[model samples]
Target: MVDDSLYILEKMRDLNLSVSTQAYNSILYNFRETDEMWDVYKAIESKNEHTYSTVVDGLCRQQKLEDAVSFLRDSEWKDTGPSVVSFNSIMSAYCKLGFVDTAKSFLCTVLKCGLVPSVHSHNILINGLCLAGSIGEALELAGDMSKHGVEPDTVTYNILAKGFHLLGMIKWVWEVIQQMLDKGLTPDVITYTILLCGHCQLGNIDKGLRLLKDMLSRGFELNSVIPCSVMLSGLCKTGRIEEAFSLFYRMKANGVRPDIVAYSIVIHGLCRLGELDLAIWLYDEMCSKRILPNSRTHGAMLLGLCRKGMLLEARALLNSLISTGCTLDIILYNIVIDGYAKSGCIEEALELFRGVIESGITPNVATFNSLIHGYCKTQNIAEARKVLDVIKLYKLVPSVVSYTTLMNAYANCGDTEKVDELRREMKANGISPTNFTYSVIIKGLCIGRKLEKYNQVLRDMASEGVTPDQITYNTVIQHLCRAKDLFRAFELFEEMKSRNLEPTPATYDILINGLCFYGYLKDAERFLCSLRERDVSLSKFAYTTVIKAHCVKGDPEMAVKLFLQVLDRGFDVSVRDYSAVINRLCRRELAKEAKFFFCLMLSRGVSPDLDICRVMIKSSDVLGWTIKAGLLP
Candidate 1:
């Protein structure tokens, strides 16, 4: 674009130039082309603007927008003789296609010139504004363009509409569309698609469908990808899955092959609706149609299969992916691992975790948490601890879910001391307890009969802005009942109701058993009767419990009568029942009755176990009779 002929004629030295001069000229023209760059450098040494602008423009033509921008910026065009237009061309190129952050950096440079921009200048700025999702500012600039004698064209409105859609500013998006229509400007296919897609996105499917039909009637076809893909996504998102599939087939009948993005949306939707078989069929269709999966499609299919708990199928798909040699990213590996882990296949999860590392993909926090949770679910606390160790090695402390999983695992395994230690460790590491952690600890404490510790953890949870869940209250109430803290137990019962958690059978069992063990035989029986009155079935332990209470009160005959009543009700006599009655009879010297029950046990085909045999021997001895206990059984 430079005027080289004028320069060649006006600037010449009288010299007998040789072969090297011709060779150097050829090298400069064919390869280096550095005359403008050299002129710009020398001009900077002497502070010349004309030569510098020339070099910057040449750099821009060569697609070196970055170098031109830096050259203008470092040259300080405003303070020098160079005016604002001196750098406008280079700046415009940058605004159009530069890196997002680099374009942002030019904002200060443009403002420093204290000069009014031209129409082209505003257009460039508008494009950059749209990319940044600054719809308000972009629209303001569009409105103010008349003040600057500049009118927006089709590209201007398209960029603006896309920006509003990106920012979810549908009102403004529609306003822009109306503005385009008022200006008698038939919007391009891109602008129409953005509005059509926006209507579908904001859940006005009727409006969206009407707009699409109207546009079609006006000879506007949804030919390119954005409109097709967005409508496909909207349809799949709603439960109108069959209609969505029909539309896709129709689009293909029009010869517009679906892209990987389109397949991903439909596949993920099918998976979400628990239709894994249909999703797999679509995935196969995608492959058979020769559409290669991008990261989104591949990740969605893997995640969808995993979500359906079809982990073996997911693993097979993953193995096929491996054989085909796709670039396995962290998300893909994590999805596979999470699918297996959530399906309770901790071993498979572990293998995938190692495979990610061995495959040179870095394991992320999600990968670690998935393995930790899987191991915790299976009560393999040691393997969970190993995941924690690996997390430390990777320089990340465990997340709240990680600590909660381990805390519950230890609790489920009856390791109260280890659970407490983990709770303290979680605190020292700056992760406060969550509701799940509180529930698990409270349940463990209740079962361990450590009432003090249970309430203390509850208080800690409240202090940390974590509200106790249903399990927390249920566990506390049950433990209080088991401890025979009758007043405190019922207090917890009322608290549970106030807190909106219904008392479970475990809760009733705890209270009833505690009352029975206290020999409050009438109260215990009333509780069982009350449960029946409320239409809540009395638990098996509840019936056995009142019998235990009767035997405890030196009423073995009544206890035996109660036992027969329990049997008549089809409650099989357990070892505890026989052991209780036999021990009571032997202790009270009812030797004949004890032997009779022993015979009854034989008649019932219930083997008189060791406890029954021992009691029979002692009772026989007390009665001045000799019966070999083994022979009697």
Candidate 2:
């Protein structure tokens, strides 16, 4: 269309017909960022203020800031300087490009040229300052607006209120509101929405409710939908799902229809709280109302399904959305592919990955990470390494997670050499090892029995300011305990406490078992008592370990006493725990005592294993005691 208009204008010029400056300005305004606009401007023999302003705006729209400034100061405007609109165009362009300082310098140029800055002139700079997190400077600029004889308007106060709101400065927001009221400026819906959002973000939900009531008393309907959506998000974030639903109904009861944002907020909240059934019900209700769900709505739903490991349903939903002409992003595909990969459906994950590439969506590091994790879970290290190579093919820098995952897989398979090579590659690529990466390295060193290298890695970890977390400590402690290095294990345990890393029951269990294995029965018992004192609830298996240790030390009486004590203390004994004691008693030549304990195991609904049965049968035959048939069963 623009080409046809320009061609007609050229023909008219050739025929000697007059072409007005306004016609040329119109043509210039419609032209895109092309050199043709410049050609047309140069053809205008006589230029007016509108002609200059049009070209200035066109240049700024094309992002040619230097050329636009040059044209403004051209000698043609010697009699009358450039207009404030032209300066605003340049300032807006500069601000949008994050050159706020340069944009502010132009304000002084506007005044030096004897042109009074308009309200818009200061508001643009104030907004830029606020966006740059320079709220202090923004307030100063607003204060100077009245001094410049440009009376601050409602839009100006609205911008100030929004700036404070965005920064979460809720307390200062009230001061801005008071200033607006003192200036006799009535707060509009936008101002109230900003205030409501501010209070909601600060977790002052009750205050936000009162503000809503105040809006109602002032005849303000909840038609904006943004304030209502803010309230829904606030309620959901605070885990008040029931109240969010009430507000959804209230919005409808008051004849204020909820938009897709409101519905999506509630749905996301429900999904987050593991209330997927209710989320689906609300989703269906929304669809019944013919309010098409947007990408956010679909994302929330897909995430909920993925969290519950419902990969099949999630993929079907994705296909349905695609069939409806929805242009899904890579994030949505990543969620589904990750869900399939983690669920051991690697083939499905790869198939979806191909679909993403075919659709021209670029795969990111997270997409490949999921595939690597999937192959690692299936013990397919060779294929997992191939996935890492594919990441480089996509021109994306592999992340720490990518390398650490594959490294851990190889380390678990006792291939420490491969783990070291990957670590070197990571360093060559400028990637730092996280705590998890160090943990994998420690495990590989333990598997290879390289004690000197293991000690050096720990020293390097500390020097690099990477504190050992619970997983790191547990890995080292387990390896030490296995090697009968209890002294070092205890030292690391105390270090974990000093670092505020609480030892889990698994950690205590490992220590207790280690002591028992080294014939330190009294020390194991002391530790067990300490656990009870600390109120750490160890599992029944921990108690069974102690009992088995006592029996192995040729103390059948002690084992029986400890078993009863654990049973009395409300720990459910397992088959192995009972077998440990009964077999020991029979080996001690106490056939009658072993049979009595067997009866007790049955009374407690614990079945004896085949080993215990064979021991009891052999003891009964040697003593000429007939075994009860029903008892054996």
- Where's the lowest-lDDT run of ten residues in candidate 1? 23-32
Residues 1-633 of candidate 1 have per-residue lDDT tens digits of: 235632442343234323233322332333223544453243232334554556566676677777776777676555564444545666666655644445545545555665556666666777777776676777788888888666887778887887888888888888888888899888877887888878888887667667665665666554655566777777777766776787677777766677888788888778767787898899898999898877778778787878878788888888888888866778878888888777788888888888887888877777898898888777678988888889989987788788777777777666789888988888899887777778888776766656567556656777788876656766676666656678888887778879886677667777888787766778887877787678775556766677666655666676676666667767666666677766776777766666666666666767767766667766676223324333543
Candidate 1 stretches with Cα past 4 Å from truth are 1-124, 130-144, 175-185, 205-207, 222-224, 271-277, 307-310, 323-326, 372-376, 379-633
RMSD of each: 16.3, 11.3
lDDT (Cα, tens digit) per residue for candidate 2, span 1-633? 888988999899999999897888888778736778878878887777777777788889998989999989874766556899899989988988999999999999999989999999998999888888889999999999889999888888888888888787878888898899999998998788888888888888888888877876677675657777888898899889999999889888877788888999999999878789999999999999998988889988998898888888999999998788756888889889888888888999999999999988898999999999989988888999998788988899999999999999988876888999999999999999999999999988877776578868879888989988998888889889999999999999999999899887788878888899888899998899888888887877667778878766767677777788788989757777777777877777777767777777878888777777788788876223323335433
- Per candidate, the number of residue pairs that clash is 0, 0
Model 2 C-alpha lDDT versus the unseen true structure? 0.85
* Best candidate, lDDT: 2
The superposed Cα distance between candidate 1 and the true structure at residue 364, in angstroms, equals 3.9
Candidate 1, overall lDDT? 0.71
Q: Model-by-model lDDT, in order?
A: 0.71, 0.85
